[model samples]
Target: MIVKKTDNGLVMDFPALPYHKIEWSPQLQALNLKQPCVIAPYWCDRLGTPSIKARQGGRRQGELLCEIKGNRVLLYGSCHLYLKGTIYLP
Candidate 1:
């Protein structure tokens, strides 16, 4: 996995997960949260992924996109990826 900033916000790109999940989707990743997140006015959703969007208030609008609805995704700006509730790295 790698931590980098996209056009608007920071994104943690995971390599282990299936590429199709995010390939050309701009939806770098999603967090496993437990709440409802209010989306800002400035946001861009994936062409077909209405559930995904690029939120504003950062380097980019989708910066919040990493957070999705905040129900299942918790995008990270200063954190790493966690798979299966476990973060394994070299």
Candidate 2:
């Protein structure tokens, strides 16, 4: 992960998959409510780990865009950013 300034705010470029909410059952919620849960074997997204471009070039990175909240993984750290997906590529 790298630290970069975004819109005048410090943001993190996490090399993690874009985890979108897949309808949680009571059992799942119980586990997730504890913060950070193991993803199921079948739970996956093909384009979730696409290439990402950082402010400076030459370094490898994954997709920056991901769901921050409401059907997305909730991220915590130096800065609290709701997992959001990247914008359309040109």
Candidate 3:
């Protein structure tokens, strides 16, 4: 997957693959009705670990850590940064 930030919005590029939507059953609706769910095989394969520990660049470089939780992507090492929000797909 490739992610790019443009002047208007963010762009995500991925190889073509099967996509499907799972409708909420009555039982599921009773549990939660606020959010709808869809499945993307490509996206599923791109799922990242919740926590990562590694180093980058020159010998003096510090570690580069990344975490993925729900819809948020977090990074921590010499600095801390995160991307948290909602994304719409059609």
Per the 3 Å backbone cut-off, how many clashing residue pairs does candidate 1 have?
10
Ranking by lDDT: 3, 1, 2
Off by over 4 Å in 2: 8-10, 15-60, 74-90
lDDT of candidate 1 over 1-90, digit per residue (tens): 344456954443332222444332222332322111333211314232333333223232223333444334444433334345667899
Give one digit per residue, the lDDT tens place, for model 3 in 1-90: 354455843333323211254432322331232111122222334553244333222223343333445765444445423357899999
For model 1, where is the 10-residue window of minimal lDDT?
A: 33-42
Q: Estimate each model's TM-score.
A: 0.22, 0.21, 0.30
Instruction: Please give the lDDT score for candidate 3.
Output: 0.35
lDDT of 2 by residue, 1-90 (tens): 454456844333323322375443322333344322222111223224312222211232222222234345433222233368878988
Instruction: Name the top lDDT candidate.
Output: 3
